[model samples]
Target: MMWRKVKKFFSALGPGLVTGASDDDPSGIATYSQAGAKYGLATLWTVIITFPLMAAIQEMCARIGLVTSVGLTTTLKKHYPRPVLYLMILFSVPAIILNIGADIASMGAVANLLFPSVAPIWFSLVFTALLLIVIIFLPYAKFVNVLKYLCLVLLLYIIVPFLTRPDWSEVLHHLFLPRITADREQIGMLVAILGTTISPYLFFWQTNMVAEDVKVIRKQVMVNKRMIIVAGNEADPRAREKRVMGLLLQKMGLDVNLGMLLSNVIMFFIILTAGTALFPKGVRNIETVEQAAQALRPVAGDLSYLLFAAGVIGTGALAIPVLGGCLSYIVSEALGWKGDLDKKFDRAKGFYGVIIVALLLGLLINYLGISPVQALLYTALLYGVTSPVIIAIILHLANNKKIMGEHTNSRWSNFLGGITLILMTLSAVLLVYFQFFNRS
Candidate 1:
């Protein structure tokens, strides 16, 4: 019975888990490492704050997909004006490209750092090609399984921190206490943390993947049944809808909470590892994931450095594709091009075309000479600025009962999502001001 239950649980894990794991991609790994190395657990509270907000907003995205059988952009077009939709695409796609570019470059940089003989550029091109081909050709079910294995890389962070032997008492204190600051640099790091943690790519990816999940299941698993009308055909249609929605919501809730919680827990551990290993040694600043790993060697141990290096490569491999897919979903949906990842490349030519274009554009960033970790921070800043707008749209759409029917957000969902919006908005505003006006 227990084995069956466990099998069922893993089977239910889908876009939520992928989204959560991708949240801690190399960009986040770099950000969290900086927080730890520079501040020494001082920023641990961020994970505490972000986990619930991330989960709530993601749930709304998932719910939108489940109820409407469409991605967020499709839902946006349904309810909003064409101009509004185009403007959003204009604002977000560039940000997504910047992010994907940075992620691709960083992934290559980390891979190069691990094996100096293999050039990072080669890694970047190869990774991009592999992701594009796999995502375009592979069946949806198989692709989800591949992503699930990538999630295991995130577990490295959880284990690596123990090698540093951090001060648990101090780590716990910082983890619980909210640290408010007016220091410009600290504020910048805080914004990066928030932005990278609950990012715009994730918002797009989660909604689209949920729709894909429904599509795959209906077309493949439930070959003889139409899931959309499954509830309506029941004896008590109203109750049946509620029951079906409840099951989906419950499963999604479990998947999302587990994924987000894991993401933040990994965040906490990364900070702890950095703080314990690098902060006291005055090796605070790091420009690449390689540097962080190298810095930890003498301070933490050789094993710690290896694990850190391995983690940077693993998570990068996991995340770079997600950044690509997120943009692909948005672009295809906005243009009314066929946009299902589960379809063959020939079948969804425009959709895969956008993905290829995005990845190819991302390659140009590597030749521009920006350090990989620095580029990651810049992307986080972009995410910080762009995500609030997306989140606001998500919240607005999630609350509209006309779009969601009876599946609109619960009061607690609204409350938590509200907190996320306000917090991200404040950080984004401060980041903008600091960059343009307060740069003294």
Candidate 2:
């Protein structure tokens, strides 16, 4: 009975787990590693603060998908004015592509660190090709399973910190006590961490994947998809359907909370590994995943370095598809093109084409004399600046009774969502001011 329950629990986890694991992609790892390397445990509190907010917002996104049976972009295009939808696409596409580029480059750099013979560019090309083939050719179910298993790769991060045996007292102190400041560098790092954690692309991906899952369920179990009737006098036929939907949403909440919790826990461990392993040794700045791994060799031993490097590749593989798929979903939905991972490429040409083009552009970014880690940081900054707008939109969508029916945001959801909005908005404003005005 216990084994069956454990198996069922794992089986129920889906998009949320993938999304959460992808949240700590190589780019995110670089951000967290940079945080720890630069400020030691000072930045640890951000993880603590972001957990509930991330879980709350992601649950909203998942609920939107389940209720509407559509992606966020589709809902936006259908309900909002054209400019609002277009403006979001305009800001989102560039940042997401850059994110894909950064992850691809980081994977290649780390691969080179593991094996010094081949150059990073060659590794980047090979990985790009591999990802392209995997995304385009694999069936959606297989692809999702692949991602779910890849999430296990992140366990390496949790293990690495312990290998160095960090000071538990200091770690707990920093985890609980918030250490923030007005310093430009520290604030910038904080914003990067926030941006990496509460990303906008994630909102679209989560909603769309849930919508897709509903589509799958509708096919596999047809009776569960019906909603309410409009005639005032008519008796409702959706009582059983409503129960099924309720069960689905409950499962989704469990999936999302667990996923986000895992994401942040891995995030915390990465920071701890970097802080304990590199910070005290005066390794202050980490610009790449490779640099972070390399710095671990002398201080944290070879096993730590090897695990860090391996985790980079695993997370890059896990995350790039999500980045590519999200961009495709946004474009396809906005343009009214057919798109789904389960569909053959010929059937979803425009959707798959957008993904292809994005990956190619991302691959091209590596040759432009830009540092992959630096680009990752800047991508996080861009995400930080633009996410508040997206978060506000998500909040509006979640609360709109017309959209959600009786499933609108609960009081606690509203409270957490509101706080997320305010906090992200302030962080964006501060980042902009610091970047443009306080450059002295």
Per-residue lDDT for 131 in model 2? Answer: 95
Give the poorly placed runs of model 1, Cα more than 4 Å off: 1-8, 220-222, 225-234
Clashing pairs in 1: none
Cα lDDT computed for each candidate against the true fold: 0.81, 0.90
Can you give the lDDT of residue 20 in candidate 1? 92
Q: TM-score of every model? A: 0.93, 0.94
List the lowest-lDDT window of 10 residues for candidate 2: 225-234
> Candidate 2 regions off by >4 Å?
1-9, 223-236
Q: State the displacement of the C-alpha of residue 96, model 1, in Å, after optimal TM-score superposition.
A: 1.8
* Candidate 2 residue lDDT tens string, 60-179: 999999999999999998888999898888888988889999899989989999889999999999999999999999999888878888898999999999999999999999999987
TM-score of 2: 0.94
Clashing pairs in 2: none
What TM-score quantifies how close candidate 1 is to the native fold? 0.93
Error of 1 at 259 (Å): 1.3
Give the distance in Å from residue 158's predicted Cα in candidate 2 to where it truly belongs. Answer: 0.7
